[model samples]
Target: MSYLIYFAIIILIPIYAQMKVRSAYKKYSEVPSSTGMTGAQVARQILDEKGLYNVTVEETPGVLSDHYDPRSKTVRLSSNNFHGHSLAGTAVAAHEVGHAIQDQEAYAFLRLRHTLVPVASIGSNFSWILIMIGIFAGMANLLLLGIIFMAAAVVFQIVTLPVEFNASSRAMDQVVSLGIIRNDEERETKKVLDAAALTYVAAAAVAVLELVRLVLMYTGMTRSDD
Candidate 1:
């Protein structure tokens, strides 16, 4: 039963979230925005209006691969979004710009997330190996270390939820305040952003579930050895 629950969280949830995002993107990507502005233009307008003059908006390859790189202060939009004047494009572009704005304002969660990146990366890379070795060797201390590492990754995932949701919120606000989309179009744009946000929620769920599974396994092993 525990394995089944773990499977659902690790497999089903992310798959469903990805399907939702792809479905929404496909549907709205074909629907042209009334503003008649390409996503690049929309992003640039928002950045400038927000006084993020140093942030560069660039066209990147791949579908739905758009993102904001705080290190370079660049908003990289997928090719379709950079050139297409579609609802999906507009929403995605604005969402990336929202991250740029968050970086400028020094959002607490975002800053903390950045600080955790190195620790989280290390934890993700080595936790599984350490846990497996500890289990095979019946070493409780080593297992505890692995759990601590996994906990770091889990904390990073939980922190990510608010960062993503906040970005979506900022995206909606910018698009509406800038008149990028009409009242009727606002709903469609929001649907796209909302779908994207679900992916992050699914990721956080997976992280939490995996951590729980590890803790349970560790406790069970200790109990059995007693």
Candidate 2:
């Protein structure tokens, strides 16, 4: 039952978070901000203020695909968020810009996460193959190696939590300080970022749960072998 519960949580939480974010974004996307700043404008102003003039803001093709590319010194905003003057658009754009600020400020966790990206990508990609081979061959050492790789991915996800939360915090602070949002708009803008943050929390939770499940499965296999 515990296993089933964990499985359900790993599966359901992300789905719920995604739905919540989409709903919130859709609701706020239609309501234009009183400041009349498009998301691109908000991001540009915030970047310039932060002395990140070298960081370019560009429109990316996709819904909710916005991100900051540290390698390129670019903030990529989704189509609607790039041009829309809505609270949701500005909020998301500001959030991505927050990442650029973090990169510039050398935010500890963000820097660490950036360093771990390639390693975690490799670990997550190959760990499943190692796990399957070990299980089929009754090799505990091989399975343990796979578990270690999965653990690396889990650590990456854990580090990501602080990086994401801090970015959202920075986004909220800058948006208010810059006068991009005010009064009721402040609260609504927060709702948009908070909804998006939940998705990151859900992703971390899923990774942790998966790591635990893998450990338990490996333990079961070893005990059966004994």
Candidate 3:
């Protein structure tokens, strides 16, 4: 029953969040911004205003595949977002620029998240395998190590929440201040960004729940051995 509950949480929340984001994006993508600026223009404008001349904006393939690559100091927007002159495009472009700004400012959470990337990557990839092997082999030490790895991934997820929220906040501020979106259009733009943020919140929730489930399982195994 508990496992069923975990499965439901792990599955349902992300599905709902994705649906919300796609619905919001699709609806707003059709509504052109009054400023008539493409997403690439918006991103470049914000980057230039912030004096982040080194950061470049480019279009990448796929829908809603926009992101900032801190390593490359580039904002990669999906083709739809890069060329579309819509509320959704403007908001997404600004959001990616927000991350570039975060990278420039050395935002604490962003820095922490970058630092955790390696550990989180390794943990996410290998933790489950280790846990399953440890469970079947009755190796307490190995099980503990898997739990520790999962904890690292959970920490990364928690750190990500702030990094994402701050980026959205920055994105909104930039669009408003730069007149990329008129005052009247602010609400719609915010809706699109908020929907995107929900996906991150859902991801974090899933990671935390998974960690909790593992810990509970580990505790049960240890108790059984005693």
Candidate 4:
């Protein structure tokens, strides 16, 4: 039952994200921001307002492929957003700009998440190899090591939650405070932001589940030895 639940969640989450984003886009295509702002325009407004002069918003190829690369000081958006003028594009644009705000404000979670990126990258990539070796060698201690690695990944995910959430929050606030859109448009924009937020949550859930799976497998191994 637990395995089934995990599998369902893993599969279901991406499905939900994709479907929701599509729906949001479809619904909002007819609804435009009052200022006639394209996503790139909104993003540029936010970046310039925040005094992040170094940050650049550019077009990338893909659907809903928007992200903030602090390293490159770039906010890359998909074709839909780069020139999109609907609720979907607006919300996505705001959310990515939200990240820039986080960067400028020195949001703690964002900072922590950035700091953990390297550790997480290393741990997530190599922990599985270590775990596989431990399992085959029947080394109980390796299970503990695996748990540590998985835990690191989990920590990164946990920290990511606030970083993402706060970004959305900042974005929504800006959209309202700046008079960027109407109240009706606000609802649609929020819908897009809300849906996008869930993807991060789903990612965190998967990370947690993977951690739990590792712990359980390691526990079973040690218990057998005992």
Candidate 5:
């Protein structure tokens, strides 16, 4: 019952954050920007201003699928955001460009986060298998090893917050400085970015809670064996 309650609470956070972002996107997407710049155009201008000529902007299929590809030096935006001349679209586009800026500037946290990706991936993929094997064999050390692996995943999620928040902050600054949005429009764009940032926060929260649950379950299992 306790686990269920905790799960119910933690699960709702991401769901709510998703809904909030969607709602904000829908609302602002209808309101056209005064600058009339499509998302791709904004991305291009930001890259040019920052002298990121090597970076390329491309339109990708899917809703809210925008992301920065560090390996390819590319910023991919979803169809709607790529073509839409709305504050929401521009805000999201600038945010992705912010990641590119981070990559270009060698932002310390972003670099650290990138370095942990492989470790986190390995941990996520094999941690469960190791834990189950340990449980069946009653090996506490193996279970603890699994916990450490999952902990790496949790650390990755935690590191992700700074990268995301800094990106949004950069996006807002660029948007305002470039006159892409002004006054009331600036407020609306901030709203969009804020809602989007919540999604990352919720993701980290869920990951931490999941790690705690895993530890608790293993503790109970070890106690039963003893």
Candidate 6:
């Protein structure tokens, strides 16, 4: 059952995101945003309105390649969104901008997660080395260390859930508050953003399940370990 749930998420979450991705673009392809503003314009407005001028909005190449870079102070929207003026573009653009707000406020969860990123990266990489040493050396203690290190990757994923969800909430609220998207179109804006949020939720769940499975195998707790 556990493995099934994990596999289901692995397969289904991307499918859902792609479906919504297609639907969002299809729905907004004909009717542009009420303001007739491009995504770059909308992103700029949100940054300005929030008194966050330090952040720069840049047009990036590729489809569905939008993201906010806190370190670089840049908000990058994919070409489709950077130039397109549609419900899909607006929602995606606003979502990236939402991360900007989180940066401005120094949101506790975001700050904590950001601080842990370096540590998590180091732990995740070295964890497998420890697992290998443990297995090859036949040392129970070394094997245990490896599992613990590898598990840090899962914890990092777990911690990321709140950061992503909070950003989405901020994005949705800003979308409505800015009135950049029309009231009539708000539902679709929310729909697209909400669907995007689920992908993150699915990711966190998969990480957690992976951790459990790893724990079982590491301790000889499963039949697979022989």
Q: Report lDDT (CA) for all predictions.
A: 0.94, 0.92, 0.93, 0.83, 0.93, 0.80
Off by over 4 Å in 3: none
lDDT by residue (51-109, candidate 2, tens digit) is: 99999999999999999999999999999999999999989999999999999999999
Per-residue lDDT over 101-155 for candidate 6, one digit per residue giving the tens place of the 0 to 100 score? 9999998888988888887898788988887777676666777777777677777
How would you encode candidate 3's per-residue C-alpha lDDT over 22-119 as one tens digit per residue? 99999999999999999999999999999999999999999988999999999999999999999999999999999999999999999999999999
| Cα-based TM-score, every candidate | 0.97, 0.95, 0.97, 0.90, 0.94, 0.84
Clashing pairs in 2: none
lDDT, residue 118, model 2: 87
TM value for model 4: 0.90
lDDT of 3: 0.93
Query: Which pairs of residues clash in candidate 5, taking residues 3 or more apart in a chain or in different chains?
Result: none
**Which scores higher on TM-score, 1 or 2?**
1
User: Candidate 1: global Cα-lDDT?
Assistant: 0.94
2 or 5, which is superior by lDDT? 5
Q: How many pairs collide in each candidate, listed in order?
A: 0, 0, 0, 0, 0, 0
Off by over 4 Å in 6: 1-31, 132-139, 221-226
Residue lDDT tens for model 5, 1-226: 9768997999799999999999999999999999999999999999999999999999999999999999999999999989999999999999999999999999999999999999999989998888888778888779889989989988999999999999999999999898988889989999999999999999999989878877887898778878
Clashes of 4: 0
* lDDT of model 3 at position 16: 98
Query: Alpha carbon lDDT of residue 111, candidate 2?
Result: 88
